[model samples]
Target chain A: MKHNSYFDGKVQSLELHTENGVATVGVITPGQYTFGTSTQEKMVITAGSLRVKLPDQDWQTVMSGEFFVVDKNVSFVVEAEQDVAYLCYYF
Target chain B: MKHNSYFDGKVQSLELHTENGVATVGVITPGQYTFGTSTQEKMVITAGSLRVKLPDQDWQTVMSGEFFVVDKNVSFVVEAEQDVAYLCYYF
Candidate 1:
């Protein structure tokens, strides 16, 4: 797994994988972003804050210990503005 | 996201998603099993104990705060026997 940090060191892609059938975990900081395209994805916010934006202009804010799922082909953006962290897996 | 628990009353699939472009998280427990097929998958153990079994008869044990990824076309199994928990996401 690969962990990458971004956004002037405020965000991170804590884990990245090239595998197709495994589970991985990561941590994100405040003002971080997890970008998605026409593909499907799933995620959960284990701690802190998170913002999810959908193509239909619908968005949501999640705080510590909250969970959400984004369906396929829905381009979206996830961001944290206040010391947030989350865990994700790809299947 | 959906959260489910199973076991000899001891395992759980904390979260499940049908989406392809988002991230989700879940928790697992002791003596729990996460089974995979020939497809690719990724996972991380945020807390507690975890055991992973590969198709080629390879396996590994993970403890609190450890992470790992599984590649495509590789079937595997994950089991915990003593009070374990984890967080996962799909992308």
Candidate 2:
């Protein structure tokens, strides 16, 4: 039931499935990246600060307990200031 | 930008994406369910208790912080005794 998928030295993507939609949780370290092309997606900051670079938009800062929905199919990069852990739920 | 996707009236599917694999988080109420046909999936119980009925397997009980890996491509049912909140991460 419980498995430890470590992202200490690498980048990984989490794909989730259900009857409604999908959700993904990404773990980003400093200088690491996670990309997406969804026009509208929900992101939750579980831990740490994440620097989100959206297409045609300036870099935005997302903190813990805060989330954002990308209204456009924008390519974004997630960078961690320290050690960032996030849960990106795509419906 | 945090949006609350409530499942008080229905069931939802969470689809996650990354370079590694997909992870899904399902929230099941009493008598609700989430199904899958994937062999060898990692599941994490964030909260509540989930009763799992696997193929060719006996009924199993999964509680908070306890997860199991279904090593065979089997259909399973998740039922809650009270109210169960779980995070199923597949990678």
Candidate 3:
């Protein structure tokens, strides 16, 4: 497992390998943040919600048990009014 | 966010505040671990699966999207054959 903390520790993730591929379960504090992806990503909201603006798409609210996709080599924006927990799978 | 590493970093978690209560998203490396809870815990498997033995219960398989509950002050054993990511809510 790999532990990663970003945005001055406002965001943190713990990495794990599953049958789906490499995945991280992380938490984001209440704030806005931008993230760049090295591979195609599928993000699942495990707890709370997020307002996500993916590349070339309008901002959308993703709630708990919902998910969104982010393409590789692109950047996206995420805003949280409350702490959000997510599972991100890289493919 | 609070970053916690246990069992010599074999297990790691990031704490987050949620509407339901305080929660932590964590990953456990392939192994067996016993944990004692201070509060009632609801554990949801997010990435992989595990064989969990809660207090006064038989060992059972908990898969992704499945959840198990443990009473406060009880200890439980979890065995993961592969990396497992989980969301634990303390109430």
Candidates in descending lDDT order: 3, 2, 1
Clash count for each candidate, listed in order shown: 34, 24, 0
TM for every model, in the order presented, reads 0.44, 0.45, 0.97
Better of 1 and 3 by lDDT: 3
**Per-prediction DockQ, in order?**
0.04, 0.05, 0.93
lDDT of 2 by residue, A1-53 (tens): 11123344344433444333555544555674656565478777654677888
**Candidate 2 local lDDT, B1-91, one digit each (tens):** 1111334534433344333355544445456565666546777664456788877788899986688776556677767765444444454
- Using lDDT, give the best candidate's number: 3
Which CAPRI category fits model 1?
incorrect
Provide the lowest-lDDT 10-residue window in model 3 chain B: B47-56
lDDT of 3 by residue, A30-90 (tens): 9999999999999999999999999889999999999998999999999999999999999
Candidate 1 lDDT over residue span B3-90, tens digit each? 3445543443423322242333444444546565344555656655678886666788876667667776555678766444465555
Model 3 segments more than 4 A misplaced: none
Residue-level error in angstroms, candidate 1, position A68: 1.7
Ranking 1 against 2 by lDDT, winner: 2
